[model samples]
Target: MKECVLLVFLALCSAKPLFRPSYMTLKNMMLKDMEDEGDGDGDVDNSLFPTREPINSFFPFDLSPTCPFGCQCYSRVVHCSDLGLSSVPSNIPLDTRMVDLQNNKIKEIKENDFKGLTSLYALILNNNKLTKIHPKAFQTTKKLRRLYLSHNQLNEIPLNLPKSLAELRIHDNKVKKIQKETFKGMNALHVLEMSANPLDNNGIEPGAFEGLTVFHVRIAEAKLTSIPKELPSTLLELHLDYNKISNVELEDFKRYKDLQRLGLGNNRITDIENGSLANIPRIREIHLEHNKLKKIPSGLQELKYLQIIFLHSNSITKVGVNDFCPTVPKMKKSLYSAISLFQNPMKYWEIQPATFRCVLSRLSVQLGNFRK
Candidate 1:
């Protein structure tokens, strides 16, 4: 009986309780098993748990019917002018025809920013803070016609411009030079305005405007001391005012026979060759205000179609008979021809009474109104 009790006590003491794992331990073991199964080199068995779909499998929500906040939209035309915006609006409709985003704070134009807008014709981004543009920014917008990028901070002309562009205005920027390929494909470009830049004569490449048939070219305040050679023959209006041009040679206006209006005001022109205006037959208006002319140019009398001549703030001391007598016949036919000689030294000089009467009467006979 003693031996049986001893054996029962030893058995009871050596026996172990049932091994039951906690809920947290069981969850950890199951996760480890799943991770090991996933890392296996063989194909995964999807019978236990189904696989989930990717996050980007669905299409984005539709936000194209309405314009961006603080913008006005009317029949596919969006106007976001002066909105204090810092970047291009993200919610602009892809089918927009015209987008006016002037007077904004936009800095850069990234690639594909204007994608999928095939009908976009006009884009106005003037008076903005644009600094850079991606190379493929306008690759999708091939139908763009008019682009206004004036009054910005662009350092050079953007490349890969659309060939369908007709009018491009990029005035008042920091463009230092125009490369030969800047407007390579721009065959339809008619009007180009690049005023108020630091462009010199060397900045333009030879045959820069070769393939182009631009009609109007304005490069005022560009620090040009001489006339740019090889100008477009189809030019009708040329504005080079507020420059450093000191003289007009005989062949300066030789190629510009179709030029109607020529602006050379506020320049340092002290002398003009007698035959400078001989080539321009259809010249109507000439602006020579605030120049250093000591006497009137002799070629002025030959311009038969001359209507208006601005010679104010010059150094003219007297009027001669030959100046007004030669052009009396031509001026008598035109009813709108006038010569402005205000704020000159002639106003303070003592003119001979006989000479003044002869010149004044002759001018009065030609022009309807004569004022000295």
Candidate 2:
């Protein structure tokens, strides 16, 4: 038995030692085993493992280029106003209907810049630094209705505007002249406001508004010394206030039969011809305040529909019976027409008391001071 044990020990010592790997070698082998268990395409089968999204995917940044960075998008309106934008933002959605980019520093509008935004209707760029607008800038937006470019630095009215436009407000601009073809295609326009422009009366050529059927036209504060000629007869309201017009000719508003409101306040008007307002039978309101008139304007009794007359802040000193009541007494029993005579030097004792009461009964007169 002792000899057998010695032989066994010698055999164990001589045999190659069993393959017992070191600690690092065993760890490497285990990692290799894990790699071998993965799919051959280098992608591990994470279906059983807990999945997690990348940390960067949870940010608030927009990756699509279809919308601008800071614009607020609603159903069909994109308001990028007051964003310190230097130009009209691109990538406006195709479904956008209105874009209000007002109060920006956009200097010009290049043609076809809004090409893809065909659904746009109202583009308000008011109070911008716009100096130039391509004639075809609004060509693609044919369905556009209102274009507000007021308070800009445009020297001339933009041409080739969309005919579908109903209201065009370019007030407070530097537009000096309106050519004959300035508004040729804008036939559907209803309101054309160009007030506070340095427009010369002669710059408006004959037939400048020939084909237009505009109802409300505002050309106030344009430095005009007289009424502009060839005005559209379809005008319902004509605002020519805050100008240098000193006299009103008889034929100034003869053709405007549909005119209801006429504004001539804040002007240097001192003389109004006898028949200047006789033809306008449907006249309702006339603003002649802050003028240099010495007496009541004639032909006020002809306006059967006249309701309000503003003649305050003038140099008038007397009131006549004929100035309030019509010669035929057609409007004697009608609603009293308000006549503002405040701030005048008319003394109640200077005029006949009976005549004054008669005029007051037919019209509502506002006096400065009176003593029975």
Candidate 3:
């Protein structure tokens, strides 16, 4: 038994190669094992571990006006109207700036409706059957300016508006109220046309105009009872016509020192406060037509540049000619100076029309010659 044990120990020591771990052998064995596992699973889960794949960045497809039938295709006019499209095109080129998908049968706007068009500026989805604009549906277009969502079935305004908006026309929809912060971060918003839709005044917050930096802004038919804060400081024109704005505080027009024209036509404004037009130094024209004013505010002496004051169809019964004499010479100096008191019961002054025409003709010639 001792001899047999000695022979077995010698056999083990003298084996072909002692069982030892080698760095190269272990690496090769590991690679073989990985290959065997990959082959066993048919490489289905190989992507579970990360591996680099070549990315082709250039767009390979051609945009050769292959829009649907009855659609006009010019440079960027994708007039898919009346073609029965279900949604907007998702695979448009990144450089697409204009899209006119109006008058279509689109009912829903999913997330993939507008996927990659980054340079799109004008999105005209008017006259469509859009019931809902999905949240973040307008995410990729960083340069969207003018959006026409009129004549749709949208009950509320979509959130996350693009920043580059300049003109928005969403009229003739089912929007009930102007949501608070609806105009947030819209710095360059200039024209907002929300007419024909009912807007509740209580939903409009005080700082709604905080992000806009407009010079002349108009909400032609918005239901506003009072002016909000941070109105454009350099407001050259304001059109608040066809609304229920009745109150005009002294501080409303005080900050608009350089206002050139104001339109309060077709509103419920009854009384203008004292010194309301005092601080507006450059106000040249005003439209007070179709208001509820029983008496004119007592501060015409402060308007040094008053031109055309339209008081047509108001409830004033009498006139004060003394308010006219002071503002005449200033109008005579300016080319854009005139007063429209038609449809009002105010007594007319004896200013000669021929003299006014002669002055305007001479000024027109001089202005035209100066422009040349």
Name the top TM-score candidate: 2
Best by lDDT: 2
- lDDT against the true structure, per candidate, is 0.76, 0.79, 0.65
Report the alpha-carbon TM-score of model 3 versus the true structure: 0.68
Please, what is the TM-score per model?
Answer: 0.74, 0.78, 0.68
Q: Tens digits of per-residue lDDT for model 1 on 324-370?
A: 33436435423324566666666433443432222323353221222
RMSD of 2: 18.1
Worst 10 residues of 1 by lDDT: 47-56
Which portions of model 3 miss their true places by more than 4 Å? 1-66, 82-86, 90-94, 230-234, 325-337, 347-372
Worst 10 residues of 2 by lDDT: 47-56
lDDT, candidate 3, 222-331, per-residue tens: 66777644565757777777888896788888768888888888988888888787877788778887887766556664565766666667666554544433455544
Off by over 4 Å in 2: 1-65, 330-334, 349-364, 369-372
Error of 3 at 194 (Å): 2.5
RMSD of each: 21.7, 18.1, 18.0
